[model samples]
Target: MSTGAAADGGVHDFGCRGGDPAASAVSGRVSGTGEGKVRSLAWNQGTTLLRAWRAGVLPRRKKLLMTNTNAPSSAASLGLLVLRVVVGAIFAAHGAQKIFEYTIPGTIGSFADMGVPLAEIAAPVVAFVELIGGILLILGLLTRPVGIVLAIDMAVALILVHLPAGLWVGDGGYEFVAVLGVAALALALTGAGRFSVDGAVLRGRAPAWLS
Candidate 1:
């Protein structure tokens, strides 16, 4: 079984598949920052730590060899899968409401009322971005770019519609949009996990970056 940690200092994973991964983890003693505390993740084993093996590095398992992480970390992939589905669902629903319920013209009217410049352009752009980008995010296709776009969309909404009310959602404040924006931004930075289409195609290959 693989393991992962949340943003908190504590580690989390699927409970008890067969063996005691926790015991093995303790024996290994949380090498480097995988101990948690949410720092920058190294794409591969630190070169400094692997210096001795540089001359004759032997291949391990196929997936492990392909991915950035040095060890199996299925739990983190699962966490990312969960995040993508939930956030994408919310985005898709809102997009559907704007497209079907409000209709493009009605959405344009709303945008005009809100004093958004170029409502004719902004309305459809926002609508399709939410709908198409949400679907892409759910499928984990082109995840990094989609995440970045969605984050910008929400940022615009937060600044234009919600910020005046302050932080409380009850007051039609920025809290909700802020959360959505930050979540999308996080995905942009991290990319979808190994369960994604990006992972399948890219396979952590020649370019160390770009999900």
Candidate 2:
């Protein structure tokens, strides 16, 4: 015969199947209560504490929808993954227009109208940077350099053309362009993610150099 405590804290008797008295005794103490207690802890504090810890130690993990041992964190990577394709397609299309529909001088004239200096030279340079930089950004190759150039290009556009327009794009204002310029700068800083060519190239490299 074996004697034990039941779930409600009462005594229970088993007729001689007592393989191990110690194990049976422990199992009785909190078999049901232990699980209930655990549930209570989770409700009261465990889950929240776990979430807070994750927030503090690895904030980047919060943003990652997928996981890999190797990943990129900088804006350049995020921009490439998030903004590259859209920006690239638009830029390439515009470049095609400059190369085909509009002559360099014509584009330069437009820039001059927008108050850009050295419109003749700046026109072709801007077109090429957009055309090429867009492609590079989308490809996740040389993302930092490409993002920097694109950010600069947008900055110049904002200063020369949009600033005078005011805030609303509907009002021919600089507001929309200014927002885009800031986003571009953010991309320039972060670089492409782990899936990018930049990440592949920088793999096994020192983090200091990359930062």
Candidate 3:
């Protein structure tokens, strides 16, 4: 007798003794005696599968899934909130120094000494913009507009006072102002994120333009 196995591990015995050839081929086993056909249909099927795989007729498949962690997750929103508060605080402190510690007149004199144009008008306006804009940024109220204004203010500072000094803040260069401007521009583009007044009020209903 001969034996064969199916792909599922089932075995069939083909007794090669005293059996009708037609019956053995159709029933996959011998009749009237233990003898059966020389080959099993299961073995042929398995070989066909292997040949197909080898020939690339039945290639294996792989599955993949992708996710964007930076696209406004909860943690990302928290980070944005932290950035807003820190940058806002720094701006507010600078504004306070100019408006109170130095006094508006003294700040204007200082700007004029630095060769800043329209020192009298620009000094007071920059002071108030920094103070009020910083507060709004920290609170995440009207964040986009406030951020845009603050960015513009930093750009003016860079052009008027810091550009000529080069990149180092210690040498009165534009590096610090440039960084602040970039941060403000980021806020304007990304909005205040989830932990903000806008987020709370909108409750996931915010339009694309707003957040």
Clashing pairs in 2: 74-190, 75-190, 75-191, 76-190, 76-191, 76-192, 77-191, 77-192, 77-193, 165-173
Best first by lDDT, ranked? 3, 1, 2
Kindly report which residue stretches of model 1 are placed more than 4 angstroms away from their true locations once superposed.
1-72, 204-209
lDDT of each: 0.80, 0.71, 0.83
RMSD of 1: 20.0
Model 2, runs deviating above 4 Å: 1-80, 205-211
On residues 7-80, what C-alpha lDDT tens digit does candidate 1 reach at each position? Answer: 87766553344657676555455544464433443424465447635644444544566766553268888888
What lDDT is obtained when candidate 2 is compared to the true structure? 0.71
**Using alpha carbons, what is the TM-score of model 2?**
0.58
If ranked by TM-score, best first, what sequence of candidates would result? 1, 3, 2
- Scored against the true structure, residue 156 in model 2 reaches a CA lDDT of 82
Clashes in model 3: which pairs?
15-34, 15-35, 15-36, 16-35, 16-36, 17-35
Superposed Cα deviation of residue 77, candidate 1 (Å):
0.3
Tens-digit lDDT track for model 3 on 120-178? 99999999999988988898877888899999999999998899999999999999999
Candidate 1 vs candidate 3, TM-score winner: 1
The parts of candidate 3 lying over 4 Å away from their true place are 1-71, 202-211
